[model samples]
Target: MSETIRRHPEAATLMSYAAGTLCEPLAAVVTAHLSMCEDCRHEVEDLELIGAGLLGSLAPAVGPAIRIPKRPLECEALTDAPVVERRRPDHLPAPIAQVYGLGFDTIPWKRLGPGVWHHRLELSAGVEGDLRLLKIGPGREMPDHGHGGSELTLVLDGAYADETGEYRRGDLQDADEDVEHRPVADKIVGCVCLIASERPARFKSIVGKLLQPWTGM
Candidate 1:
């Protein structure tokens, strides 16, 4: 899956994620993408190690010593412990599956517009940003729009293409305020994607703008 992915989040974005500085919404999208792309996972791991090394160089804060509690030793042997098996839907990414807590077929999609359906994901209280799953009908073209801040989109199923390039399953699109284009879904399979945006998208058309308030894109 990693070998086939042609797009990924920018190095800066991954670095921010590794440094624990990325916002929750964007971090969720990155997490979903990492589940599919091993190359990106390695990159993030390397970044995290580097960050850990830097933090280790800092002096420890002076404070009163605190005692730590120790766990009691288990009486049972390791081989006697029961093994548990857990399974998740094959079609959905691990992070998404855990958050959604439902199968893809059972998702309650809401109509956003013609040929477009969306399911918004709830964030923790006071968290700023938008995160959602979008299902676009075959050959449907999205409205031309630019980002207000940053937007990270991960392709979960099917494919879509825009001025930048075509994105297939496991591909991630990292768009910022400077990017402006329209994406069209594949004619046959359509497309289903997980999108996280730092701010609302800026639609170029009046119809798109009118629908924006309701759609909350």
Candidate 2:
């Protein structure tokens, strides 16, 4: 199949993901993108194979005995958690669903502006980063911002465009401190995206700057 994704994560980023060295949230975003992108999926698979080959080349080392911990009886029943069937339009990619546990409608969205809403996701303890779902109304303009570190955004539905280019469903936009721009949703349908940020965004506009502290972006 032809490559559907226009923007892709860099080789170094993909390699870090394959090596399991990326932060949890960033890895989750890349995994979500990989689920919708065939070309990137194939590339990740190749990297995994290469990683396995390198591991096989290492000499076996004798390590200290590891003790297997027993799980408490109370935790046994907790494994049977309820799962909701995801609906259309807001159906999430597998990676995201695995981490989020709930569908789109179930997300608790906080109104960020007239046409923008966001749902901040809580990662497991010790995981560092900001991960969230952003839903923007049609013709809405996202806050103009620059990055403190790196940011990864994966479009789950509809489309949006920024100074770099247009991003549609299944597209991943990779931005870093070097990138700066405001993204606007398509006039007809708006957009919904999964975003993972290494650090808080630095807003450019006066209004955005005023709201940045409270928004945590």
Candidate 3:
């Protein structure tokens, strides 16, 4: 899967994730990509090690002494207990599956337009961002648009192509405010993507703009 993944999040984006600085929505997209791309997983691991070393080298800040709380001796008995792993759907990434909590085929898709469907994911209260799963019908083309802020898209299934290039399963496309393109779904398989954006998209077409309030893209 890593070998076939030609697209990946930018180095800066990975660094932010490694440093634990990315917001929940953006981090979710990166986490999904990392699950399928071995190369990216390794990259993030290396980045984390580097971050740890840097933190270790920094001078410790002077602060008030912290108190430790005592726990019952029985609490230690659970130390040797086997861990129970949560099962997830094979087709969906772990992060997405955890949030969606449903099979891909069972998604209650809301129509965005003729051939585009989306299901928005909920974020914590007061969280400022957008995250959703987009399902595009075969040969469908999205409206031309530019991002208002940063946007990260992870291909969960099939493929899509834009001015940048083609993105297939396990591929991640990182776009910012300056990027403007119309993405077209694959003719045969169409596309299913997990998208996270810092702000709403800026549509080039009036029709797209008019629908933005309803679609919440």
Candidate maximizing lDDT: 1
Local error of candidate 3 at residue 94 (angstroms): 1.6
lDDT of 1 by residue, 41-105 (tens): 78887777777778884433221111011113222233354433434356677556655454566
Worst 10 residues of 2 by lDDT: 62-71
* lDDT (10s digit) by residue, model 2, range 17-65: 8777877677778877776778877787777777777888543322111
Computed on alpha carbons, the lDDT of every model, listed in order, comes to 0.80, 0.77, 0.79
Instruction: Tell how far residue 24 is off in model 2, in angstroms.
Output: 1.7
**Ranking by TM-score, best first?**
1, 2, 3
Error of 1 at 17 (Å): 0.3
Residue 201, candidate 3: alpha-carbon lDDT: 92
| Poorest stretch of ten by lDDT in candidate 3 | 62-71
Candidate 2 ranges beyond 4 A from true positions: 1-3, 57-86
Q: Give the TM-score of candidate 2.
A: 0.84
Query: In terms of lDDT, which candidate is stronger, 1 or 3?
Result: 1
lDDT winner between 2 and 3, please give it.
3
Order of quality (lDDT): 1, 3, 2
